[model samples]
Target: MKSVARKLSAVTLVVIALSNGATAFAQSKVTEIPVPNLVIYPGDLIEEGMLTQQRVLKRSIAGMPIHRHEDAILGKEAKRTLIPGHPIALNATREPLIVRRGTLAKLIFREDGLEIIAVVEPLQSGAVGETVKAKNLDTGLQVVGVVQEDGTLLVEGG
Candidate 1:
């Protein structure tokens, strides 16, 4: 009778353990998600809390299908996804070049139309109609223009 009781308790414990383990495993399954249409390359920013969908790329890392999410991943505070080719720039530096008023400059033709090539010199105190020459950085063409009060050079190039 004693041996029978011990065996029954052991069996009951095993059954309970198995039942709990099965429930946990079911909850841990990866959920199926949809794929996105946009192209996401490495070094692009990503953020969390944004919707994410998978993408079909020509090639994927480790044979895993590519996934894309909306918005850049919020840095450092979110869970990092180990997707290959996704690089985040933390602290970006580099100030934009600004052209001041009364500076001599040149215009160069570009796909976006004429752009300031360079500033020859900034305007001097009480200098009116300062002469400045600028060469197009892209086309190597030279242009001359006078600076205006709005920090823009008016150049007429052929």
Candidate 2:
């Protein structure tokens, strides 16, 4: 009977120690992250003024690409609905599309001091600096080009 009581005491101590450890973890360090001030729908642009700071448990965001800076999210379009006071995931937003699918844009090619410009219909839409496929309107030839900031496609080679 005495041995059983000692074992019970040891188990009680262990339980208490575990409970204390959990309490300490609950009060662990917090990180200040930016969150949306209101509901942000997909395709809506994120603005600096539309964000607010929130304190989150550090461990809760482990291995997550949560946005910590305003500059990282500013002027970006939301890819999913963002609720107020929730940390924004890095993949939740994207650069705004400068060129849309099936849109006619100028395709410029430069080689050996010669520059050639032609009209192209973008087969896919993309943002600046993104590569996409376009069809040359003049020659009906398929080509790959990088989308430019001005919504133009710049082709390389012939």
**Candidate lDDT values, in order:** 0.42, 0.90
Q: Please write out the lDDT profile of model 1 over residues 1-158, one tens digit for every residue.
A: 99999999999999999999998776554332332223433333433433344433323232443222233233322223333324223222111123543444433223346654453443332122554455544455555555454554566455
The numbered model that scores best in TM-score is: 2
Q: What does the lDDT read for residue 134 in candidate 1?
A: 56
Error of 2 at 146 (Å): 1.0
Kindly provide the TM-score of model 1 when superposed on the true structure, using C-alpha atoms. Answer: 0.26
Q: Model 2: per-residue lDDT, tens digit, 1-158?
A: 99999999999999999999998877676778899999999989998778999888888888888898888999999999999999999999999988888888989998877889999999998999999999999889998889999988887675
Highest-lDDT candidate: 2
> Which residue segments of model 2 deviate by more than 4 Å?
1-28
What lDDT is reached at residue 147 by model 2? Answer: 90
Worst 10 residues of 1 by lDDT: 88-97
